[model samples]
Target: MELILALAIGVLFSSGIWLILRPRSFQVITGFMLLSYAVNLFIFITGKIHINKAPLTLDGVPVDPTRYADPLPQGLVLTAIVIGFATTALYLVVLLGSRGLTGTDHVDGKERDHDE
Candidate 1:
């Protein structure tokens, strides 16, 4: 399980770096997504993984909380997921507006300037 998590982290990191290096704004968005996923995974792995563990208290039974996985990471990941979605949506809107107004998506605005 740990190996799988490690492999996933590596792949996500590589993908994020690759997308971030691209000149396109859309690729940069993808890179951000990948990086966020990698970060969430790393945070989760720090807490360690457990199997067949109960999430909460049971009737008349004292359970060892350490034997179960931490719920904090899951909540954090959910929050991150929502925030990432919002960020991606906002980025797309800005990219589209930029392209529509300037007639180019490039950051340097060379395509629009050439038209003048």
Candidate 2:
């Protein structure tokens, strides 16, 4: 499970970096989302995984460290997910607005022909 998480983190990081280098606003936005996902996954793995663990408390049950995972990371991930969604929506609006105003979507602005 640890190995799988590590591999997933690596893949996410690599893909995020690659997407970020693209010369497009949308790609950059996607890269940010991917990086956020990688961070969330990394944080989640830090708490360790347990089989058939219940997230809520149960009556007449002692606190079992081996059976229960930490809730802090899960809470953080939830917050991050909400924030990510808002940011993505904002970015999409900004992208559309910029394109509507400038008639281009290139990260560095519109390309010019040397002959012009």
Candidate 1 wrongly placed segments (more than 4 Å): 111-116
Worst 10 residues of 1 by lDDT: 107-116
lDDT of 1 by residue, 14-79 (tens): 999999887677788889889989988887767667677655667787777776677777777788
The ten-residue window of minimal lDDT in model 2 covers 107-116
What TM-score against the true fold does each predicted structure earn?
0.80, 0.86
Runs in model 2 lying further than 4 Å from the true structure: 112-116
Scored against the true structure, residue 67 in model 2 reaches a CA lDDT of: 72
Per-residue alpha-carbon lDDT of candidate 2 for residues 2-115, written as tens digits (9 for 90 to 100): 888899999999999999998788898889888989988887766677667766667899877667768777888889888888988898898888888888887766755552
In model 2, state the lDDT of residue 65.
68
What is the RMSD of candidate 2? Answer: 2.5
Error of 1 at 50 (Å): 1.9
Compared to the true structure, candidate 1 yields what TM-score?
0.80
Error of 1 at 28 (Å): 1.1
